[model samples]
Target: MIVYILNVIIMALGLYCLIAKRHIIKKIIGMVLIEYSMNLFLILIGYRINGLAPILLPEMNRVQFSQYGVDPLPQALVLTSIVIGLGTLALMAAYAMKLYEKYRTFDMSEIRRLRG
Candidate 1:
């Protein structure tokens, strides 16, 4: 329950930053926070009580398969998500720099050029 509450709080904070913050860099930080929250939530969901490592050996038999096992799917998914987030963050940072260079300011309202 605590984990769930924390996840919700993190999500709320990210949403608030996204909606209330005026700086593009702040919005990017909010997006990163949101992504981290989602990843953490996913990891929490996959957590098991007394779970063992999901490793296989050539000499191992199926008789004791239940005793030494762990979920690898979530780990793989998390890794992929992290890679995607890194790419997104890189792109966002690049765009922010370009925007700053063009507008000479980081204030979102002052940088508005399409007020149509």
Candidate 2:
């Protein structure tokens, strides 16, 4: 309950940074924060108290495994999301670097004003 609320707060903070901050690097950091918070939320959704790993041992019956095993789907989804986020972060960083090289500033408003 509390964890979920904290996750939402983190996401909101990230969104605020993305929308309210004028610096490109701050925006990039905000994007990262949002991604991380989402990943955390997904992981929380799949968590079970005293849950065992999703592996099936020979001694464990199907019903027992089903009841105790942690969900693998959310974990797999998070892994994929992480890879995608890394690619997006890299692209954003490259774009920011190019912008800085051209305008000598990371401020988005300054960049906009300098554009001809």
Candidate 3:
């Protein structure tokens, strides 16, 4: 619904920042934004109105649980993606720091020009 559209808009803004920004830090921020929006989208996909957690209890019938439970797969996937994204973000920050140490600037264009 509208939430999906908003998610797409956020992702587009991240793409714009990644493509149009000159600063390395800004690009890293953009990457993180895109990662977060994707995680949100995955969570939204598994959401259900009036849904309960996908847990089974002695009183709950199998049919009712199947009909009412929100999906757990997407949630698991998002969790995995978050961990992977954190690792990627850390690697990117390390590279940025090294670039700054060498070039004295976070501007990507300047870094390219200074390459020897």
Candidate 4:
């Protein structure tokens, strides 16, 4: 229950950062925060009570395996998500550098080219 609330708070903060901040760098940080919060939420969703690793021991029966093991899917998804996030972060950082180079300031409102 507490974990859920924490996740919500994290997500809200990210959204606020994106909406309230006028700095491109801060918006990028908010994007990262949103990604992290989603990953955390995914991990918590996959959590099992008294869960053990999903390793199949030689002596363990199917019944025991089902009862003791945690779901491996979310863990795998989180790992993939982390890698993707790193790539995205790198991309965002590169974009931020370019924006800084062109605009000479981090403020979003001053970047007139972005407006449609």
Clash-forming residue pairs, model 3: none
Ranking by TM-score: 3, 2, 4, 1
Worst 10 residues of 4 by lDDT: 107-116
Q: How far is 60's C-alpha from truth in model 3 (Å)?
A: 4.2
Report residue 58 deviation for candidate 3 (angstroms).
5.2
lDDT, candidate 1, 6-71, per-residue tens: 897998899999999999989998999999999988887777678655677777776665654656
* Residue 16 error, candidate 4, Å: 0.4
State residue 82's C-alpha deviation in candidate 2, in Å.
Answer: 0.4
* Model 2 per-residue lDDT at 19: 98
lDDT of 3 by residue, 10-94 (tens): 9999999999999998999999999999999999999999998987999988998899899999988888999999999999999
Backbone clashes per model, in order? 0, 0, 0, 0
**Model 4: CA > 4 A from native:** 57-62, 113-116
TM-score of each: 0.85, 0.90, 0.91, 0.88
Give the range of the ten consecutive residues with the poorest summed lDDT in model 3: 107-116
The 0-to-1 C-alpha lDDT of every candidate, in the order given, reads 0.85, 0.93, 0.93, 0.90
Stretches > 4 Å off in candidate 2: 57-62, 114-116
Q: Select the stronger candidate by TM-score from 1 and 3.
A: 3
Can you write out model 4's per-residue Cα lDDT over 31-84, one digit (the tens) per residue?
A: 999999999998888889998888888888889789878889999989999999
